[model samples]
Target: MQPIDPHSPGVMPSGLHASVVDQMGLAIGAGEWAAGSVMRIEELEERYGVSRSVIREVLRVLASMGMVESRRRVGVQVLPATEWNLYDRQVIRWRLASPGRVAQLRSLTELRTAVEPQAARLAALRAPVADASELMGLAGKLWAAGQDGDTELFLALDIQFHRLVLSSSGNEMFGKLNSLVAEVLTGRTHYSLMPEHPHDEALQLHVDVASAIQRRNPVDAHHSMLAIMERAMTEMSTLWDEAAHK
Candidate 1:
């Protein structure tokens, strides 16, 4: 696995413990440590040239993420993927960084497809006037950012735009997913999967979604949002294919 970049903003700076976590997370996610495989803390400490204390800390972090469990007599055992906190931002990032990145993106895209259109419809039906207005204004800013080729500004605005929609839906479950959605958007840009110029149609669809919500037209809002996800799926698939071949 490629080492996480130390200079990358938002990435954890590498240290004995951080490095161990990243390596072990990748190893487990990539199936290097199969489910139910037990690993001794003493062995890990010696293998990584770290103290038992550091190794224990790393295990604790992994356990919190539902990746492993400590048995009374047996060593730490890897958990099944179903047990993982897959929605945790750090877990999502680590999965994206691992070899199963294409599969991870595919799963996330399907999840977005299922949830976001409904979120858009709910926003149309439930958003207050001010919240609807905010969506429209954010849509304008996102379009301008894209047209100007402002990558950083566009990405930030894009994340905020979707986050606003999910929150405006007035559904607590949707609101909780804001960070996961942000991670997906950021992942595309971070992986160099984004086009140099944002797709013109996709930008227009954002405007359409905002307008539909502002008009309280749930049908249009749902369709427009679905269009956006459909386009993204196509783009992501193409990028994944290109990356796999390369």
Candidate 2:
């Protein structure tokens, strides 16, 4: 997805510990450190040019995310990718950064396809009036940004629009996926996966979804959102094929 802004409020703190975590995470994700490969704490400390405590903390964080497991005598072993906490934002970011970026994007988009339409439907039925109004406003801004070829603004607005829809769904579980949606939208834009200028139809579909929610039309909202997801899949498929052939 999108590049995580280093200065962003909740981003990983900057320091040796974070650097070690990121480097090791990226290495593991890129298959440089294959699953089942082991690295001792002293080795990690030396590789990262950090101290034992920093290395230990990095492993602790990675272990919590299911990226690595530390054994009593075997050291830290990289786990299989299938065992990772896929929902963890850092893991998602690392995967997007790896050679598997395209596949990661495809998987996340598929997830959005499955989840967001229903979220839209629930938002149409349950969103507060204020939130519905805000979504409508964001939709209008998205259209403007898209038409103007303002990719940066469009990306931000698109993320916000989807995040609001998810949050307004009145399902706590759905609300928790805001980061997932943000990563998808961000990744699409940052990785050149999105168009220089968003398609007119895509912009209009966003408007349609917002309008349906504003009107409390659940059926229209569901279908409109589904249409959006279908278009994304089509666009991504074409781009992915082109990239593969290149």
Candidate 3:
């Protein structure tokens, strides 16, 4: 294996190790790396043109994600799929690259539907006035951006809206669900909205949710979020099933 400086290609060297860890984890989970495979750092170092240090750093990251097992003399060996960390960002990416990933997303969405609507209600009871106002403001941003033929920004703010809502829930565990929430939403953007019609229907629901939360009406917030999730889950399920069959 040839050694090269990871910073030389330097497109995003800070993220390089993470990106490589994600890619390699994806390959392994997608069966390209296969079970029982031994991944020597020398070969990866040569392939990615990153240095041994960068490769080892990436391997250690992957090992932590439960994608690879490493020992001083034994090298890096891919672990069985069952051992992987589902919550690890790279592992989640890798899992989604496999054939049935959309179904996984659907399941996650269903789980979110269960958790987030309740969280919205809980948040309404205690969310700071500023947080409530901010939620309102984000909802407005989402609506205006969607109406302005800016689907990209709309989607970005849309995810942020939910993240903010979760953060307002006053529980660290609820806030930590942001990553899982982001994962589901980011991966399914194309499936959920078209560039041409991105802002059509979501505005009303988001407005309702924002207003309810601001009013500190927990029941109203609950219903508003629940209604939104129900529709989204139904639509997403159909879309995901179709994609799976294709």
Candidate 4:
């Protein structure tokens, strides 16, 4: 699907409501306007220079995402961060942008554990050997670079690992999620709310999974990838619990 352009002029056509909704959803998730913050329709209208209809359209989209509540006099009140829908694609993007994005990252990482091992297993069975080999090659490069402490090289290669995994999985739904995963994992400083991970465990896990895939060992690939996600979850759980307290 083509990305929606928010920069265009005039009353955004009704067709663009989904795009508008996604943008507003992201802003709210990013904590652009904090909890209890009033998002006056007229003000947003002036801000976006779009029709009240479009603004409402965006707000309604946000409402559906559990990002806000609308009432007569109370107007639009931004709710607590946790209230927002974390699963919706657009909601996930917004949460990735939040100031406290570490918690969101933790959540995403946790989800990866549940979904990706199965994805890897299926990919092993379904993906052509050549495609799996290519992905494993990229993972090898990523592992070496990560061990070298080359953040740039490590990130680029890490992205390849996911793209290849999704492609190998041959599942369109999970493939679409790659875009969201890519954005969150890359340029993470934009919405950093968590501490940077110490050590090189993530890199090593990538190597193990890559090796498993290269050897066509679906079970090992599955469990190895799952272990990587598990460690991340464990580290992030304490942070998430602390954030929830506040």
Which candidate's lDDT is highest? Answer: 2
- Arrange candidates by lDDT, descending: 2, 1, 3, 4
Error of 1 at 110 (Å): 0.5
Q: Write the candidate numbers in order of decreasing TM-score.
A: 2, 1, 3, 4
* Per-prediction CA RMSD (Å): 6.8, 6.6, 4.6, 6.3
Choose the strongest candidate by TM-score: 2
Query: After superposition, which runs of candidate 2 have C-alpha atoms over 4 Å from their true positions?
Result: 1-14
Q: Can you write out model 4's per-residue Cα lDDT over 160-179, one digit (the tens) per residue?
A: 78777876787888777776
* Model 4 pairs whose backbones collide: none
Cα-based lDDT for every prediction = 0.89, 0.91, 0.78, 0.72
Give the per-residue lDDT of model 1 (tens digit) for 83-173. 9999999889888887777788888889999999999999999999998999999999999999999999999999999998999899999
Tell me the spans in candidate 1 whose CA falls farther than 4 Å from its real position. 1-23
TM-score of each prediction: 0.87, 0.93, 0.80, 0.68
Instruction: Put down candidate 2 lDDT per residue, 217-241, tens digits, no spaces.
Output: 9999999999999999999998988
Off by over 4 Å in 4: 1-27, 30-39, 46-90, 187-201, 234-246
